[model samples]
Target: MTKAMLLLKFAGLEFSEDRGGYHKAPKGKLPFIDDEGLMVADSTSSVFT
Candidate 1:
């Protein structure tokens, strides 16, 4: 999770830490992106997108 945060920070993207909200993410995972309305799950997928 820390690594994801750091990468996002390096990318200069603004995001909020959703504490205790893993259940709301796709695949019930952490470090997902709710970009405009698109959902990208996990760091690898996000980077590619």
Candidate 2:
């Protein structure tokens, strides 16, 4: 979660932080964002998948 926020900051992108938990997350995964109403789930394990 912190890593995602930091990446957004470092990239100079303006983003709103949502504190909703796993149940409200995309596919029940953590650290995500709604880009043009698309639920993008950011997971490090995706590389392994």
Q: What lDDT would each prediction earn against the true structure?
A: 0.79, 0.68
Model 2 alpha-carbon miss at residue 12, Å: 0.5
Q: How far out, in Å, is residue 13 in model 2?
A: 0.5
- Scored by lDDT, the top model is 1
After best superposition, candidate 2 residue 3: deviation in angstroms? Answer: 1.5
RMSD of 1: 1.7
TM-score of each: 0.71, 0.64
Cα lDDT, model 2, residue 44: 48
Candidate 2 lDDT, 1-49, residue by residue in tens: 4776776777798889877688767778777767667676864442223
lDDT of 1 by residue, 1-49 (tens): 6777888899898878878778778878776778878888877777777
Candidate 1 Cα misplacement greater than 4 A, ranges: none
Please name the candidate that would achieve the greatest TM-score relative to the true structure: 1
TM-score of candidate 1 to 2 decimals: 0.71
Output the TM-score of candidate 2: 0.64
